[model samples]
Target: MAKIEPGNGLTSAVSRNILRGTTESLALTDGEGNSFGSDSELNAYTSERQTDKYGFIGGAQQYSEQSAENIPPEVLRQREAKWLDMLNNWDKWMAKRHKKMKLRCQKGIPPSLRGRAWLYLSGGKVKREQHKGKFEELDSQAGDPKWVDVIERDLHRQFPFHEMFVAREGHGQQDLYRVLKAYTLHRPEEGYCQAQAPIAAVLLMHMPAEDAFWGLVQICEKYLPGYYSAGLEAIQLDGEILFALLKRVSPLAHRHLKKHNMDPILYMTEWFMCAFSRTLPWASVLRVWDMFFCEGVKIIFRVGLVLLKCMLGSQDKLKTCQGQYETMELLKTIDTRYMQEGFLVREILELPVSERDIEKEHLASVRRWKETRGELHCKALPRMHGAKAIMAAEPPSRQDLRQNPTIIVELPLATKSNGEDKERKKTKEEKNGKKNSSPTPVVADLEPSKPPPPLKDTALLGSNQSLSSTEHDTYL
Candidate 1:
């Protein structure tokens, strides 16, 4: 387990001073012509210190941290696999194992055992019949070449620091492009999506291209159902549910947030969407990936909710909306105590029934909302507003106020105005039943005679180099 220290933000002197409300100051020279240090022999004449561990003060210690990467590759990595086996059987082993799967994964399955594991655990063994002979058929089509352009758009930006993805016109980059391009050709409906990046990066360490491509296909189709959809609306809804759980469990933090106008999007969004890849330790992250292969998307929600419980107070509410998109920025510095609790895994497995019960609640809430809509005369509210009106609108058999969540979650005095006050602005216009701002110029704008241009996805992978870029651009 990698150790992490807590204390939010940069932790430098400048940040500490700002937190202390101190004015910035700097002094130059001995203006009074006196030495602050003693002139005694030892104090005046010692040599500069040299130590390996210290960092951040710009001496030998600082130099070492910046240069740690310069250590021989053998140091950061063990050399046991120098001329290792060239195939993988991990997936087969993993599928049959009952325990310590996370342990076996980190010891680095040798190359000989790597490819098969990548394929089998990928759920690709079952897909062999479905995709085995398809690449050649795909290449025979005119559009086969076009998928390369799309593949290129995502790969270089996926894990740009890795040798396999260094944004170069080289063998590794070309091999990645070929596999993704072939996969896209093989499954046009699921042509591509951002989910494949970390998956591909992990596989490239062990498996060859062809096998890895099939595994990627299996992961998307079998494990993540809404894998390639635009805007990821399905995943976003899961986020809303996760946020609701966080509020219920950590209400004080939740209330503190409402006081500060923070949305859960400020921290929990990426933790759910990306499964804490950037929030937890890298090895811990691999543990998640392994379980993800075994259980599917439900584990993502479960593991994410568990991580949110683990990282309780570090979540800040004041960050801007754009800042909420990734977890790494906030998580890299969260105190280890957040994840250090010894009871985490058991607690997760034993999580409160209410926390993980969203599936049942979602449908019930939907039906109740629809029932309320049918009985509009009870109250005038939006399609999904007011638990009471919704309950009243439902069938007579379901009309008890005790069965309704609005009464349970809120007092009976609740009307729309009070229930939403903590969550929304109590604006003068909203109170007066008028629009807050002037209406947009609803001028007679003619619809275009021809259809508009096809929508393009510009969320090309890892580079925040620019948030949006099209099919042809490259960071290089």
Candidate 2:
């Protein structure tokens, strides 16, 4: 007989029986009739005593597995097989089947394959390989204190309900910190932005630390340059572009919004800033990201138009809102029934918008914004080219950042009095001689002596606070 050491105060026979999968009931005490504690107490103590050795400190369930379980097994298998083939011959597949790749992305990438797929789709793998050991270097160094506190403050607020981020020092949150901090270090000028937190958190859920970091870089530099910078010039410009597109796509909603003195930044900031992560349902957010990485920032505009149409399209629905604040409240707290992942995705896919349409509107919006602000030169903040050297050294396919010429425009100051504001705006439009023919341009009554300060708080649009997560979930 082998000598057995005491384990959790269990006797050799009891331990053996339990290990052998026998469920015989045993007394709580020794033969002396003393109490060893009740079964429930023992179980509670054992459960409480358990610690995660690997430091993940969360549920064992994989996000990919949970997301994939809804699909039919055969469908999942086929998708997995296709994904495997793409992975095996990535270069060839990307060259010949690029359109096919986009089509498949529109259908939604399989959750099981999403991790690797995002890596390939974002070209994160190539960037990661080229800049090997760069993340470790950045991670080892301390991040600037300017961004560290801000990053820490927002860490727990992101995905608090999710298992991966529930624990304060869990692997997920830690990786998120490293990635965001690394970016701050990577581009000291841009520092950090609150919107980047949820974006990085989402990425961390899908891939490892380094890959997630590079993916974030791709998004910030290529897909959304100047967005996370101190001045937020890109998002400001894009907001104007979104408003322009909205006017064309849904004239009623646009007119109603304009009539009430609502600005695009009022409701659209969160929509564009976080790439719809904080606003949309989790499942829908994932699908949107799948297409977004492959298609770039154009997906964001399409989805925003669809959302606005869904929320404020009908005259009856628009009638319910009394004022700008009420209209904004209605827009922010859209009902989930209308935002079902599959239904919403189908609507987004069916929309007749294209990148060229967005680009054309973007240029026009930039021109209008600059003209309204009475500046001929671009006054927006410059792009951070810190990673340009590394990106330039990589092959064309591996180059993560696309150097689109920055189209800069000034953000107009919010008007104060409704009556005076509308009169001034109308006068400006009439002076421009395109009031009725074109979408009402967002223009300021007075251009400030100096540019406004960099936006530090969540209130990117103006003094009004951005919608909280709870506010976002509430139905109007």
TM-scores of all predicted structures: 0.47, 0.67
**Candidate 2 lDDT, 43-88, residue by residue in tens:** 3533653433211222221133222226687886677667656765
93 Cα displacement, candidate 2 (Å): 2.0
Candidate 2 regions exceeding 4 Å error are 1-69, 374-476
TM-score of 1: 0.47
Give the local distance difference test score of model 1: 0.40
Candidate 2 clash pair list: none
Task: Kindly state the number of residue pairs that clash in model 2.
Answer: 0
Write down the lDDT that model 2 would get: 0.64
Candidate 1 on 354-444: residue-level lDDT in tens?
Answer: 3236655445444554575432112211221111122223322212111101111112323455656634544755787865444323322
**Model 1, backbone clash pairs (residues 3+ apart or across chains), number:** 12
Error of 2 at 184 (Å): 0.6
